[model samples]
Target: MTDSDRERWDARFTGLGPGEPGPPGALVGREHLVPASGRALDLACGRGTVAVWLARRGLEVDAVDVSPVGLAAGRAQAPEVHWIRADLDDGLPVTGPYDVIVCQRFRDPALHPALIGALAPGGLLVISVLSQAGDAGGPFRAPPGELLAAFGGLAVLHHAEGHGEESLVARG
Candidate 1:
């Protein structure tokens, strides 16, 4: 993302209320899939909700997002998380052999390979993003089966696209 994009996101997040703590969407009912002890990374972790959630679950967590306002909000609530401010357009800001990696509401095909590579063997990956499959077309949305095709090498557990969203849960 460009500086303008970062500024825009910062502004938007700065104007928002506090973020609510919540588990990652994919881990809602499948919480058992999360390892009880291991490192996790949350990319585009908007206000550190999931990052905080993972840390509370006994996993070391690193959360990254480009917006400082968002990071600050996260920091206020979960200071335990290692928050990294980075423009992912420069590529992933943190390296990892993570047990759990989540990228929600963000799409970037270029990072697909890195995301797969970052996972440790048998690690879990949870991803969700806007999709054009069942929603009106948009420049930022993925086409049908995008996640399924991009991360085909992983052992897929669940995949769905509809209602303007596409979600995937898989293990490496």
Candidate 2:
């Protein structure tokens, strides 16, 4: 992403402020599936809410984002989390064999393979993204069946698409 893109995200987070800790969007009702203790990675982890939640659940957590302001807000909430600031446009910076990986509201088909490769055996992948399915299509929205097309090989535990969002929870 460009420096202006980073600045825009920083400004947006500055306006939104720190977020409350919560389960990853796709894991909201199925929180039981998350391992009680394991390594976790939150990609494009804006404000680090889900990352902090994972840490609180007794998991080692790494939260990555492009905005320093957002990372700072999350770091304040949980100093234990390893907060990484890097433009995802540079590509996935952290290698992994993570037990749980989450990417919410961030769509990059280019990283799908890297994400799947990062998971440890029996690891869970939680992802949510804006989608055109059941809504007026837009440039940023994924086409219908996008997540399934990209991740169908995994053992999908949950999948939902509608109302401008697509979410999936699958085991690697």
Candidate 3:
């Protein structure tokens, strides 16, 4: 991401305030799949909602984002989480064999393979993205079946596409 991209995100997050930590969108009804004790990585973690949630569940959490302002808010909410400041465009900064990985509201096809490779045995992956499946198509939205096409090799736990969103939960 460029400096302007970071600044744009920082500005947006600054207005949103410190967001409440919550379960990942894809894990809403499948929360039991989350490992009780293991390491987790939250990509494009924004205000660290999922990262903080994982930490509270006894996992060591790493949350990455480009916005310093966003990280600060999350840091205040859960100081235990390792809040990383980096652009995802440069690829993942932290090597991983994480027991759980989450990417919510962010879609980057280039990162999908890396995400799969980073999972530990039987690790869980929870991801959600805006989609064109049940809405007007757009450049920023994933095409139909995008999640399954990208992650079908995994042991799919759940998958849904509708209401302009797509989500997948799988075990590696």
Ranking by lDDT: 2, 3, 1
Model 1 superposed RMSD (Cα) = 1.1
RMSD of 3: 1.0
TM-score of 1: 0.96
lDDT per residue for candidate 1 within 1-172, as digits (tens), equals: 8889888888889867557777877768999999999999999988788988888889999999999999888888888889999888889888879999999998999999999999999999999989998888799999989999998789999887899888999999
- Find the candidate with the highest lDDT and give its number: 2
TM-score, model 3 to reference = 0.96
| Per-candidate clash tally | 0, 0, 0
Candidate 3 lDDT over 54-163, as tens digits, reads 99999999999999999998999999899999899888788889999999988899999999999998999999999998899887899989999999999999999998
All models, RMSD in angstroms:
1.1, 0.9, 1.0
What is candidate 2's lDDT per residue for 15-117, written digit by digit as tens? Answer: 6767999997788889999999989999999899999999999999999999999999899999999999988877898989999999998999999999999
Query: What is the clash count of model 3?
Result: 0
For candidate 3, the 10 contiguous residues with the lowest summed lDDT are 12-21
Instruction: Score every model by TM-score.
Output: 0.96, 0.97, 0.96
Task: Compare the candidates by TM-score and give the number of the best one.
Answer: 2
